[model samples]
Target chain A: MKARVTITLKPGVLDPQGKAIEHALDNLGFSGVEAARAGKVIELDLADGTSDADIDAMCRKLLANTVIENYRIERL
Target chain B: MKARVTITLKPGVLDPQGKAIEHALDNLGFSGVEAARAGKVIELDLADGTSDADIDAMCRKLLANTVIENYRIERL
Candidate 1:
């Protein structure tokens, strides 16, 4: 089985990288980009039948900070 | 309107970050993690009714390197 984790910064957190992208876009003549948030995606190839609980644990332990970030897991 | 761009390395591209994560998972006792690939997700808050073509152009010009990565766009 395959699993995907989408990790994003929580609301109210400052994202300098995202801000840079937004500014760059504006400079490149792409107008009307109100904001941008940069995040990460990790795709895992796992053994079949790996439980969702185990995946959730991985996220909590190592994949995300959990304090300033939020993560969502999808099984594929 | 909102849009998401998921950028992933092409299959043949080398991903040292992904490899490091895979090894770290193994060291942390996460078995069954056969492989891992790291990617990026950028969420954009754009003006309403921003044309898909404009989004695609932004991706091509700034968000993704088409020679080495593939990107998927989702409008929300």
Candidate 2:
């Protein structure tokens, strides 16, 4: 089985990396780009019969930093 | 309007970062984790009425490294 976990900063958290990328984009002539927030995508190949609850626990415990980020899970 | 762009490496591409992360996870006692792939998520706050086609073009032209990555866009 395969799953995708997307980790993104929570709203109101300062994202210096995203700001840097936005600045670079502006310098590269991509106008009208008001803001950019950067995040992480983690693809996992799991054993058969792995429960969604287990995956969610994994995200909460290790995959995402809940202090500043939220995670979404997609199973494929 | 806001759009989310997810950039992921094409299948079969080598992902050193993902591998490193996986190794770290294993060291931290995350068992049953078969493989890991790392990617980028970029959120964009665009002006109203930005066409999907234009956003796709932006992704292809700048947001993703098409030589090894693929991108998907979502509007919110």
Docking class of 2: medium
Determine which window of 10 residues in candidate 2 chain B has minimal summed lDDT.
B24-33
Give the per-residue lDDT digits (tens) of candidate 1, residues A1-76: 9999999999999999999999999999999899999999999999988899989988998999999999999988
**lDDT of predicted model 1:** 0.95
Residue A68 lDDT in model 1? 100
Over B11-30, each residue of candidate 2 has an lDDT whose tens digit, in order, gives 99999988987787777776
Here, model 2's chain A TM-score works out at 0.96
lDDT to native, each model: 0.95, 0.88
Interface RMSD of 2: 1.6
Return the clash pairs for model 1, or none.
Answer: none
